[model samples]
Target: MIERPDDAPGAGLSFDYAGFGRWYDSYRVEVLDPALVEVEAVVGGLLRDALSERDLARIRGPVGRVKSKPRAWRKLSHRRYVDRIDVVDDIPDVIDDLVGIRLTCTNRRDIDVAREVLDALPVADDGRARLWLAPDSERDYLDRPRPSGYRGWHVNLGLAVDVGGSRQPVSCELQVRTLLQDGWGELTHEDTYKKDGELPPLVEVLSRRMADLLSTLDDIAEDLRDELDRLDEAAVTSAPLPLTTETEGPGRRAAQAADAAAYLGTRWRALDRPVDLAALAWELQRDHGAEITDDWFGFGTFKRFLSSAVPAAEITTGRNAYILPADPVPEDDAADDAGADEHDGDVPDGDVGGHAESDQTTRHGTTGQGTAGPGTADEAEAAVPAAARALHRVDRTFPLLGHDDWTRLFDHLAEAWRRTGAQPPTDRLARRLIQSTRDRSAASGPPLAARHVEAVVRDLVAEGDGVPRPADELAGTYATLVQQRLVELRLIGARNRNARAAVRRWIAF
Candidate 1:
């Protein structure tokens, strides 16, 4: 039996050790349900203590993937235990990173605050009491960084996972890093380090040099953060004091409402998943717009507002589920000349959100905002142009995923999501994103990109569309998905964004 890793209320309570007998065993996926549980349970605890929006932004991962099968085998094949029984009994210690939740921040100050919060984790039994943390479980990379220049804060944590209706103890690794540190990893292709080989001497030397440079940048970033904090404090102090009628004036109230709506609207639109209520609340309060929505956010007033200008059904998964109001009808501007100023090169009508092909999916018993209902994938797939499907294929040796392909693919995904009401598969999308990132030796440094990969995967898992991708043939298909994402910027130079940005980086010789 695995010993308890921490003193959380139900840590490691009668967990099924036999469940993880092999890397590819049936329970491999089953055991992963806890990783999902660990991400939110931990992050939410951190958020409850955040004093400001800047503090909230310090922790950006909704969560990333549970380590994949191929990656797991690479990790344990010779590194930990060779036999299954030894591995299963001491699971928490052997696989300390089953669920890796990265908290990427702007500066190191955020990391200090996060460490303080971790001192009193919210208990999981009912999300209330403080879960006891083992003081020795923390690994501080900053104090003794890897010679390769790697830097981050790591900690092993324990929590109970619900498996087959039984509460079982599980574990996760919380990685706290500043954005600059993450970016250095991305630019350096550091993720491939998990695959078990030292980098070529030239690459390693360059990576180490960049790591040192990034460390200096981290110091500069802290200085910039201190300056910003001072400015923010100054603004609050210098603000006009509230009088009998000054604080909540009608004009002030309207401005606040408009500001919050616009900020949240744009942010939600950019994300592939929902923003946490705590994060939303903090930002709203910072902007002085918290009450403009409602008093009790826990009731989902802001949640409904967040979905769209109109009310939408809450997503069963407990993240944000939204229903956008229909596009406003274009008015005939009383003159034909109103159209004269429009660009002739305006994305062709069928080229963007208005694809005629989506109509086919809509007609196949799918409503603009109704569930595609489990069987709609086939219908949705069949409805898309064959050329669109053809473009998903990778050349393996050359860049093949293109802009037009991405345009149609996004258009199709947008339509499927719109007609079916189910969001597109973002976890697979994140995997695809990670794959594409790994394939690009030409991509930016490894630090930030790696962290972003972790951050995006976390949110995707929390949201719906849990499309499971096989770990086989990963090398062949790696670049296909991320290249599409690079081109997913609403079709404005996105194609070139991937191609052009590749050479734009300055790597050390």
Candidate 2:
């Protein structure tokens, strides 16, 4: 327990501005400021990241504030310290709301998500979280409203603040509230919360009545949001079924494989882009009441892929494995080329490789090499890698094909074959479509479309349903689509498995 001074009720320590001000200023500069920065960086950042742009649009702010000298003095002068916090040593705990970070969400779900982000925060390497919720510090005003009708959720967060050179533990408060609740609180904040004295009967009754009405509004908004989300979900899940069906061929194999999403390439499966260990650990602790450090290793996965190669070699595998090749393959020209252009097809961060790209720039910007300033076409051609130049040769000769362009061409090809009982002259059709797409590439379509290839086989044999359609050459296209779908499904399955495995590891931890 902190030994606090119990000064006189009237004007005691209130008039001594210099003494209080000096302490307050030093405390604010040294302790409060760093704690605020730490909380905002860790808590505020995580909350904002948890919410999408749509959610953020509805949310007001993760805004912060510091308690003034008067508020701190008022709380400290109490006979027993507010929550028995040390005023001199633990100012942040004493003035729990010394640094207030408010995230006023428009609805309840966003508020819930914001709180979950903090509640499930993982501890750092020092066996501590940079900012953490202090025990017994949460106040659910919304669930149990105050007498004066204020509604909000608050959790006091302890921060590991680094003063001049040493580590100082400090704390702040995080407030989450719906827009309506925030408005109600705003109206009654001063009247209800500030003064220690009792409020008038009329004011008290009206405030409670107003709060109940706004609470009703908040509930309605949440229901409406849930309804809208269900509708959107239903629409997305209602994608068109596969174009064709097959029973006794590659198409059938593809159909089965694609449906399972469990047969993608081994390398792709292994590299399901590892999940955040901290997040995984946090989830484990929250859901299962198991604590674990955010440390994950992929040695098990590595052994699964490459252990067979060294079974005959006498080696005892430990936590760390150092594997050397029994026979090194000689590097040839093809290998050299492959190595040089290994990352050629890769999509850089923020430069996604897909159609439906609007105002999109490639690894090479708008006008290939445009982002690389002041270079003539000849100069660019000279400077550009031979591999890259070769990669783009086909695109320069042929016009880029958008999703619509490919669909139209495919439809025409099928129609042509059906009418004549023979493959049509795709050269003329291809030429015409290329020109059409080229003319409108800038005006109406993605400029870098067709940089990658993907075939979706939903809706080929319009009559297939789930049964195998008549064996036709056109059905071969459907087979190809099925093949593509199988690969995609495998990748998806691998990712799902990886996620599950990650969670399991955390659970074990």
Candidate 3:
């Protein structure tokens, strides 16, 4: 009766312990691996959708195929068990599961975009996320940069997911960044974020400085990219002219070819043309003439022409050449000897009368055909010189007046002055003259009388005397002049509020 039972002795207990060990191994294989796989697939899908929505093409490849690798576990053998005999209680409540995704990009901006895309993803209520750019990552090694200098972004996300049908949750981690950052991280991860005395003081300081320098260099590169974009836009918008039969009339065509040759040849000459006149003229003839002829031309054509005809350095430096039209002469006069015979005309004998006739004759020879008289040519020529000189001065002083139209107008005024022997008009008078001329041309009619231009000029001069005209005040005067002309042309009523407002804005800088 006192003999040990077959199922109750030490031998039976040993067999039970062996069976429990086998069951624990089976749980890890069936439950833990599959749970981790599911979590990884869900998170990966979330990241891919976010990046795709943001149009971040660079991160698409890396995010779409992310996975959790090599499941890891920590055993809490001493912890309380759920049941007296259950081994599941020995497992820790939170598993330190880690998953990461890597992205590659050409520039740092792409890295930033990836980081933003990840942050925007919908996270579980119990999850937490963090983002780091460049140097903040573990892979960033300032002391030793990679040969390729690949820089990138990083993100650390903490997610909580259900496992094994348990009410409790497990924690998981996620990381995102570029290939360059990943490489850098791999190299320096051990030395970074060490609480122990792993990283030496000197190395840490040097690493920080190098990181700062690299960041600054990246910023500079971005700025250069922006500048290149602007230059490309300018080039596209400023392509060369075209040539066509109607546009390339024999006479104009010859003149255009000669002008182009002159422009190319003058590259070696000093840029001291009397008013950028030569440069303005050449552009007009080449651009407008070729356009008229329906001849297709581009930057390459102009560049090639300049390369052969002009100095290489001048063409490289972008020095422009202009070819102006022959200065407009009196209807009956020649361009070169226009005012030379002013004193030869029949004249009344007196300083007042003779001087007045001589002045009128000189003005007549310089003004455009059919636009000269007692007061017309004198006022027109007077304003022309000052406007031309002002434009020239501004071009040299400030960097404005780069527009071809503005420069061409200046050249025309200078030519008029040269042919008329006229003095520069006051600024007020010059402004009025320009406005009147533009208005008349737009209406396909003759300009206002020179006396009328003079009156407006006199009013402006009086107003501007001893006072710096605020930009608005000057603009207002031009607006008034435009409105008055528009009304005189009978195209619009004087009371048109919309027209007045538009003119005001147009005349404003």
Candidate 4:
């Protein structure tokens, strides 16, 4: 346990921002680092032993971090705390949450269970532990959030460490929150937007409104879980027979399952280009006894099936995987040539592999070199999709798409624009999407595969019900309508030679 000295010579001295800094640097290296390591080891081991797999899955993160040096100094420099202290000596004595762990859960019940587990843990004689419930001000936020819209529970614990035979207690803080509260808090983090712990009036009002909306969403999630449970019970009683009964042998069943996904995938690509994921999910539940949730992995499985079956699907692995439409063949070739030419000419003076190149320009603006530029092409070509996807506000529900699904979509869009002799949409959303892909590639490496533009077009398209339909029916009608529109435009533009040329260029493809 860390204890402050009361009778120091410079007791009650004014805040010395530099004085605190000098001691903290050395203290951190010699004392804080080693102490934190031991405490974390103890806590981590305790958690591993105590929690079951199901309990562990319920938790999002049990991440621990030492309070950064700068943040520590900022706390100590405060006049109120320093004024109470006699010559502020140590960082730990001033800041209670020197080492901290944060845990996020899906609901209030999970939060309570986690807290109970922590509270029941054993502590050695050398250590001291204390847990503080949020005071009235904070409690109100949990029940009815504050103006800043922050809602979470905080607990502070101090564990004793033996440094060269003497036992010293180091402080650690634990924060617990529901998933909804955690998401809102992260998006509007105090450190990111608020300086000096103050929010502008407008920001405060908006945040409060967001908090209310988030609370409503949380309630909806709870309702959904309840409704799903009722549905699950109904499904148990009346659901179709097991999929295995549909075929005679296990091998045949497996083959049929695979074939079903492929057949459905073909229809989806031809009709919608991108698979109608919701329809796919419904089909799986209705026919195949597969339960799909809205989580990343659940949706990812759906995408995986679609990608395998449909030429349009794209898939990626790891935490931030996603799918989008594929790139056009001509646009891809054009961009590849452009990227290759740029790479050859633009190698910086010192770096070997364009390492020193900071801002490599592309058709999408200044993304680093070796990147496919933005709009549809950019999404398919991004080496790291997470950063780019975040920038574009892409849905994060699915972790992977059918492989090359995004590539096909991009290619079709590019081809359509080219054939029409009209530019593809280059609005703010498109630019941001492109810029993000480039930025991600620059930071990371090149993408897993260079998106291929040339892919076979299928005649069968999937309906919203995930059923196959003939593309010829729609294609013939669509072509005739477009031709009529083009003729009308040509007749109107007959008076202007330039307009005629533009119209001809558009329809020539």
By TM-score, who's the top model here? 2
Local distance difference test scores for all models: 0.44, 0.43, 0.36, 0.43
lDDT of 4 by residue, 94-208 (tens): 6777677778888654564464345333222323432222111112145545569877766555566667777766666777788988888877775457555779898888887
* Model 4 CA deviation exceeding 4 Å by range: 1-15, 38-46, 122-141, 192-196, 229-509
What are the TM-scores, per candidate, against the unseen true structure? 0.43, 0.46, 0.29, 0.42
Which 10-residue span in candidate 1 carries the lowest summed lDDT? 500-509
Question: Candidate order by TM-score, highest to lowest?
Answer: 2, 1, 4, 3
Compared with the true structure, model 3 gives a TM-score of 0.29
Candidate 1 off by > 4 Å: 1-23, 83-93, 122-135, 194-197, 239-509
How close is each model in CA RMSD to the real structure? 25.0, 25.6, 27.9, 24.4
lDDT of 3: 0.36
Give the per-residue lDDT digits (tens) of candidate 2, residues 198-305. 577888898889999999999999889868644432322232222233322224334432322232233223321221212222332343342111111111121221
1-509 in candidate 1: lDDT tens per residue? Answer: 44545432223433332334463465457767555666566567556533335566666764656777656544554432434325344544566676667778778766655654553332223433223333346676875677677888777656666679776666667788889888987887676663345676777788889988888988998888767654433332232232334433234445555666677666554542223344454566666743533322222244434444323322222222222213321222222223323422321212212111222111111111111111222332223221121111111111212222222222332332343334355555555544453333113222222332333334434443544332221211333343343233221123233221221110000
Q: How do all the candidates rank in terms of lDDT, highest first?
A: 1, 2, 4, 3
